[model samples]
Target chain A: MKIAIDLNGGDRAPEEILKGCLEFLKNHPREKLILCTTKNEPDNLFDLNHPQITVEYFTHAVGMKETPAKSKKEKPDNTIEGTLRLVKNRKADCAFSCGNSGAIILNSVDVLGLKDPNTHPSLISFIPLYNRPPLAVFDVGALGNYVFNAELYFAVLHETVDIYTKLYGVKEPEIKLLNIGTESWKGTAEHKNIYRMMSDSLYNFTGNIEGDELLFTDASVIVTDGLTGNIVLKLLESFNVLLQNFRNFKDCKFDNNYLNFLIEDFNYETIGGAPLTGVNGKVVIGHGKSSSKAVRSALELCVKYAEI
Target chain B: MKIAIDLNGGDRAPEEILKGCLEFLKNHPREKLILCTTKNEPDNLFDLNHPQITVEYFTHAVGMKETPAKSKKEKPDNTIEGTLRLVKNRKADCAFSCGNSGAIILNSVDVLGLKDPNTHPSLISFIPLYNRPPLAVFDVGALGNYVFNAELYFAVLHETVDIYTKLYGVKEPEIKLLNIGTESWKGTAEHKNIYRMMSDSLYNFTGNIEGDELLFTDASVIVTDGLTGNIVLKLLESFNVLLQNFRNFKDCKFDNNYLNFLIEDFNYETIGGAPLTGVNGKVVIGHGKSSSKAVRSALELCVKYAEI
Candidate 1:
């Protein structure tokens, strides 16, 4: 299997991404990689001399601060778009990037197109819970610029259920709407309308799940709008940072192994990357601050999708 | 100061509420209390013979499962309404309850009335951080039923700024909009529009704050719509529960005092209660599952508001 990796994506991009590529290739020597970078990137920065690695240069790269629409119009031949194009042309089985989430979603849609044009690209993340099977959170960051509509939500819901059942082997996973309260009338009028739609559908639509129950929920799939999902996913990730500050505040050392057990799933380094479902081709996204290990895990994750 | 306490609110009511009142009176001998309960409540359930304590009976009480609109129409004379009436009539200096938040907002507006008719009641909670002074999170639950409008949001912004300055003595606090991303074009068009309004206004609008920076932000005030605020507040509160589960999973005990310092502000037991601001009279709301100690702390919080 072959995977295309975007080198001009995150903060420590080209350097850390190259290291991750080398690490991934070392473990899986048979796999091939297409490394995407900017045309201006100096060749001496890293030795891309391996037979397993191929370099694909792009004309422009999206900045972290650029809006998706502005970047797409101005920087048409960006690195993320070029990387996903490899998957589109079947040059690579899948693709991985650690770029701005909005830009990634737009580029993925433009390059690979959507399986269902009515639905936006939904980012599904597997959340590890204590003493329970991992829970799936949908649309972590794919719909930042989109508006809310019943048809769009229904499409995303079906996409989430289909992908989750296929990956986790749950025939009919309980689907829960992420809301402020468990009661049917907890959120705004729009939320109630969505709740009714989910209930009327053939899926196993459980009522509502509040943020407090996020870590302890028995439901297999939790669906939310892209904005809410993005905030929630980041909030869970921030726990790793909070725990570190807490340990420092207490001026005490915890056994590193035990601490890892408590927060391993919450960290990108351990949990790896999330998949952007609903797209025609397989795509995995890493955290923008992803370390070398995290980037490698993202590639490994892309490989898993390829196998699936 | 005479404070009205809702005895028909919360999971452990009557018995727990009585216990909290007793605890409050023991420490504050000069304070007066008016206990509100349902007419069906047994007289022998608790002793209310003290000179400082007076019992007031109501015809109905709002249940946890009932929607605010249904309850308001069906049960017009609920215990929460009766408790706030005491404040409205100048019979009590302030009021506190662990009742349904929606009902509380409706009853507070109907009874005590809003300070600004255009703005919805905003629930402001003070969050304790690790090293910095406490941060304020606005509209934690009050806007659950309201729709988005610029005039309403502007009113809420001013109300939050006024209250935060009065409470914290910050002349011009840095105001932040809670959003999915820090970029100007991060959220939906509606969010970008609000961001523009805040930036153009005289308040120190400090761009957008993401969920991950929630705990680490240096901004004094974080403002958001009710639905987002409710989810964020509950997510922060859930950390206390998460920490307990982690300790159990690890089978190791840390010093309880240090643990208290880390999560105290996040819990109603330590933070006491959050005030529903933008109302003419003081209204404090407690957690539904608040322990007797939390109830007492909430009443103490009401006293602080009364003095102000």
Candidate 2:
């Protein structure tokens, strides 16, 4: 299996990304990799002589703050586009990028077209639970600005169910809708309409789940509009910071090991990246400020998706 | 100042509600209370001979799960309406209820009436911070299903700023918009429009604040759509439950004091209730499953608002 790496992506591009690629190669010697970087990158950053590694260069790299639409219209040969192109042409089984999430979604949609235009791209994040398996949250930010509709939400839910089933090896996982209340008649008109649609669907559809029950719910997947999903995802991801503030509030010096244990699954480095599902090609998007270890973990995730 | 309380409003109606009033009266000997309850309540539960407490009888009580519209249309003289009517007719300075939040908002809007028909009623919740003063979060559930509009958002924000200033004694508190990102161009078009309107307004408006920064942000007030605000409020309030799950995951015995200290401010009993602002009268809405202690706290909160 082959995976494409955007070496010019992320805040610490070209250097940390190169180290991550080297780290991945040390672990997986037989797996092939296609590296995409900007031509402006120094030669010292591209010293990998492994036969399994192939290098591709682009003229420009997308900035972290660049608008996705402007980047798509202005920078046609950007490194992100170059990285996704390998997957489009079937040269690489999947692609990974730590660049701007918006740019990645836009480029992935352009280079690797969506399976159904009505079904927008969604990022599936696994919410860690106590004893049970992690809950899958769909559409974290892919369709943030898009209006919520039954058809669009249903398509994304279907794709999420398929991907979640493949990942967990579950025949028909239970799915729940993230809402303000658990009552079926709760939420806006749009949400009420979606509720009815999902209730009649073939999936193992459960009732609505509230924010307070998010971590405790037994539902395998929680479907929500991109706006709410993105907010909820960020809030949960910031758990460590919240705990630290609490620790500081007491002015106590706690052991780092205890804090680490508490935040074991909450660490972004461990999570690596989230897949941009509903697109034709396998694509993994990492955080904007990902470290070398995080990038390496993201590369491993790309390989995982490719192999699956 | 006299506070009107709906004794038949909460899940633990007359008994716990009456106990709360007795508790409040015990603490504040000089304060007067107007207790609203249904005639169906047993005489044994209403035998309190406190001269400071005045009882008002109603024919029916609103159920916790009943729709606000149906309750308002079908039951005109419910306990909740009777309690709000006391505030409307200046018989009481403020009102408190631990019933359905939607029903409270709807009855409050009808009985108390909005200062501006264009502006809907909003709940202002004080989110406790570690070392700093509590942050004011606007529109927690009052306008949950309402569509996003710049004018409506600005109106709610104005009312929040006014009430927050009165409560905290701040001449001009800083305000921020809750969004997925801090960027000016982030979020949906409606958010962008609201952001621009907030920036141009005369209020001490800061830039957009993300969910990750909700607890740590220095901004004194964060204004958001009701749906997002309610979700964030519930998630933060459930911090104690999340920590309990974490402790259980580790399977270790931790001191309850440490857990209590960590969740000291998150305890709903201590917080009491949130005020429904922008209406002609002061209204405090408590949780549906409020205990006697929580009911007492809500009564105290109503007194606080009344005195302010």
Q: What RMSD does each model have against the real structure? A: 2.5, 3.1
Worst 10 residues of 1 chain B by lDDT: B245-254
Q: Score candidate 1 by TM-score against the native.
A: 0.93
Angstrom error at residue A256, model 2: 14
TM-score of chain B of each: 0.89, 0.91
Model 1 alpha-carbon miss at residue A214, Å: 0.5
Per-residue lDDT tens digits for candidate 1, residues A244-296, read 55454344445555455665545657656788877899888888888888888
Please provide TM-scores, in order, for all candidate models, with all chains considered together: 0.93, 0.92
- Chain A TM-scores of each predicted structure, in the order given, are 0.90, 0.90
lDDT of each: 0.78, 0.78
Q: RMSD to the native, candidate 2?
A: 3.1
lDDT over C-alpha atoms for residue A119 of model 1: 78
Runs in model 1 with CA error above 4 Å? A131-133, A143-146, A245-259, B143-146, B246-260, B263-265
Question: Each model's fnat?
Answer: 0.49, 0.32
List, residue by residue over B172-255, the lDDT tens digit for candidate 1. 899888788787776767678888889888558889998888877889988776666777777777777766554543444555
